[model samples]
Target: MPVRVVDSSAPSQVSGANPSHTSPPACTLLSVGQAFSGTQNVSSLQKDEAWRVNVRIQGCDLDHGYLCGTMEALNVPMADTPWVIQVVTFWEGEIVDMKNYTFFTGKWEATVGKPFPLMVVLSIVNRSEVDTRHWTKFPSFSPLLSQVEVDGGRSLDLSNYPYIFMRWKEQYFVNVGTDCGLTIAGFYYVCFSCSDGSINGFYYDPNSSPFQKLELKITNEGRSGFSFSSYELQ
Candidate 1:
């Protein structure tokens, strides 16, 4: 995903602090989003630096329909520089299967005058149906995730993490989502099962991955374990 530089005049805002801290930690869906602004006395050319930024994406400003990202740094020095402060805000309750997938993002801050200014960019990973137009579907598998775990541990929360799904385009496929490493590189190892039997799984994510294809070695064994293996871009 590519980040965008917003107008310094306006920035995004954050609302709805997660009291329960239940929002997925991956997207900071429940963390505080804050903005910063201060005039720096540029006595001499300063070296590159970083500043913590806040982006609040709402209906007013949206790139696609939602924003799912983490803190990123702008190369420009946060010291002795004039910058417009902004915060991109989004609804704190966006946690559902398909609806929570929409993200709207905008607003940014820019520092004036520098050898090579680098503004912290507001990057995006669009989950809108339109962006997934070219995705291919795979054979449907009813994986009974009774013994499956996510990343690690025994908890499987499909809302924030990737999971198995059945029947999308008359073919069965895995819903990797904008998450589950859509931009990740190499193969995806998926493990799941159905009531009829159990199966070992793997996925080969081609470039521009999405609606990823699934490969399952269907069998009636290995019913008490879960494992995840893959290589993702850093």
Candidate 2:
């Protein structure tokens, strides 16, 4: 099936999770794409029959000298075919979350000190002739590491962050391809806001606890998808 990638143009919220209290910082959406492989063409399905999937960001802590957040997938369709979705952190080479069925969707969170790329991989197979559509969205990181100046004049590198990190819960969709095959469509959002907040504490007593009041908002303008199997950071 022919695959298409789209990026979002929303802004990132850089404050505490309270959106009603303050407006999120303006952020540019990044380009996103999906990777797939197989002999069957899956893009012939109808648009209304397509599934919608998304990942929602529940929490994040870049100020406590580490990066941590909660996430979950929503509105994924159940399939008799073998299907699985998982969160993999490249910095630690760890699978943060994994699910085999659509009913197994819920909240998952993680924290890490090392800056590296992360990703979420989904594997699905529909043996039935009937067309199926499902939508889904997941949190993702660009896997591209850049030098970021944290508070307190400390410099950190996220060059190795997972090319894809679905650490937070979001939205999504999956649908039938044009060839009467199952088409898997989804989105990936990227950001570089994970950090350890020694910078916020520099203004306070050095011996005191690090100030943990800063928030990091990461945003992208589109979505990306990937094929089943293992993916690595370059």
Q: List runs of model 1 lying over 4 Å from the truth.
A: 1-131, 134-213, 226-234
lDDT tens readout by residue for model 2, 34-116? 11111111222343222222222212222211122222222323344355332211110111111111111121211112212
In candidate 1 the C-alpha lDDT for residue 76 amounts to 26
Error of 2 at 230 (Å): 38
Q: Write the per-residue lDDT of candidate 1 for residues 1-234, one digit (tens) a residue.
A: 111221112222322111322322233222123212222111213332223322211111111112222212223232235642322222112222222211121111111221111232222212112212211121321232221111111123333343322111101112212221112222222222223222222222223223332322322222221111221211
Backbone clash count, each prediction separately? 28, 80
Q: Estimate the TM-score of every prediction.
A: 0.19, 0.20
Superposed Cα deviation of residue 57, candidate 2 (Å): 2.9
lDDT of 1 at 220: 29
Model 1, C-alpha of 105: deviation from truth (Å): 15
